[model samples]
Target: MLSRTPKMLLQTPGARRGFHSIMSSLVPMVLEQSPRGERVFDIYSRLLKERIVFVHGPVNDDMASLVTAQLLFLESENPDKDVYMYINSPGGIVSSGLAIYDTMQYIQPKVNTLCMGQAASMGSLLLAGGAPGCRSALPNARIMIHQPSGGAQGMASDIAIQAEEIIKLRTRLNGLYASHTGKPLKVIEQAMDRDLFMDPREAQEFGIVDSIIANRKAPQSSGKQ
Candidate 1:
């Protein structure tokens, strides 16, 4: 077994990348020696390391990397357990959020997402991407989803091309939100034009949030591989 380390507390944006990078680098090195049989799992449970992921600030590349690293580590260290991701982010960087979304979809462990405060824009997308009936929010949490925006500099043609790409992304996202929420793309499209915001109950009705959390409860997985 590798040497046990203290809990990595990622309280600041600056600390996230540093912490998960350590886990990312350490996994391959230690996996061979990591116990697979029924051994004490506290080593992985410290700080709820393998079972929980937090998105508490703006979404960005570092946040994406952190979430990726955490998922990768948990996949390697505890593939059978459930992961609880709590999001309280204001959203940022569309590509970063998409990266995190892809990882959440690709990872082996089932992910249950809870919006503890607010999830807007990309954050709302992330919240809706949770595994099946696993999407939820605090009773007072808020959610917002809107068309993505982008900017480009340089040649006029290049700017027009970038604008077209942004429009494409908006279309893609509208369909994605529709798929998850069971709403039609046109409905989502109109709402994005005005920056739709919803409380927990409204979000559930909108199909973005599956349940409004009234207390702490561990969600049951769908048991699908």
Candidate 2:
């Protein structure tokens, strides 16, 4: 029975902290052995304990896939618990970011998004899309939103089709932002016309984040363990 259970599972606050440190130490050695070691040593094992998911670096299909899986798995483990998402991304593929965003909403647990460094473009969308009243950013974090840009080179007709798709996507994004921020769709479109950048205070004012985390600690999760 014990063998059937997860070996890296850490219960209790102290255990989570202690094992997190231990796993951090083990990650380098594990990486030396296998390139895929991060999946086992760094992300999944640590995630199971803290129920925290990090969306670091540029958002892409692979990153989106992993994050979606983690969110679903965490929800499957405990639907009532709040999941914390730490995002520090420069942004990337639109569809990829939307995949993660959709999954965030599909999951039952409330997701609390905290911008660590920057959440620009699609990253900004994900931040704004977090559970209302739960989105936040570090004091120095930057947030940005802008119209989607795409490239099409096959033919003029194809380019026009791509342009149309981009317009539709931009509209969808604007609607989502307006829904989350309580701002009007036209306002969102205007703000997204150019790269609108914001610091924590500005982001909060712009409705990209609910609060600025100035306490230097992770924000509290709303759900009981």
Candidate 3:
């Protein structure tokens, strides 16, 4: 029985001002309530012996941190089990996104990404971070990659620092794209610069995605297997 009512205690004046503080304390519980929690609870309730974990939702620092912790836990407890990642997000902060991607890569889990809606920008990068043979996207869903952009403010030196940061970000972005798609770095950079949005079919054609989940067919070998 999940509580649908917003907790009024979280809405009080003092609570409002310290909302972040209080939320930080409750973040663990909220994150567990996300897809991961449901999967764990289901396994326990059904008394199943197999391992299955679902990591899904909007990309944010807090959520990434939570998922990272869970991934670490899984690696320690059940290192051989395949971890399913269901991604549906418009993406978030660059650092947060990269942190999640790095964490996933560190675990080296067999991650199957079932995109129910959209996996755009950083979300796409995270999906690509999965083990080579385990990455995937649903047929009706979309995956988009583009140049990273952010806002900055400060003095002349500060502006120069921000410009440098953007250049580095773009370089990293291009590297990720080239590694995943096996396309020429310049070609991937051009597509990202042009803000390409790819459907599952187009992604497969471009070698950005390994296989299409259409017609209820099983995933094809990604050449890594």
The model with the greatest TM-score is: 2
| Local error of candidate 3 at residue 196 (angstroms) | 0.9
Steric collisions counted per model: 0, 0, 0
Off by over 4 Å in 3: 1-57, 215-217, 220-225
Better of 1 and 3 by lDDT: 1
For 126-214, candidate 3 gives per-residue lDDT tens digits of: 76666765666777888777787655555667667777777888898789878877889999888888557788777766666666665
Query: What would the TM-scores of all predictions be?
Result: 0.75, 0.78, 0.73
Candidate 3: how many backbone clashes? Answer: 0
Q: Over the stretch 1-225, how does candidate 2's per-residue lDDT look in tens digits?
A: 122211111011111122224334645322324565533354445554688888776676667787899999999999999999988877777888889999999999999999998888878888988998999998889888887777555666766777788888888888989989888888998998887888888888778888777775755332125
Candidate 1 per-residue lDDT over residues 18-91, each given as its tens digit: 33454445332122234565433333345455478887677777778878888888888878888889898777
Q: State residue 217's C-alpha deviation in candidate 1, in Å.
A: 5.1
Candidate 3 differs from the real structure by a C-alpha RMSD in angstroms, to one decimal, of: 10.7
lDDT of 2: 0.76
Ranking by lDDT: 2, 1, 3
- Which regions of candidate 2 are displaced past 4 Å? 1-40, 216-225
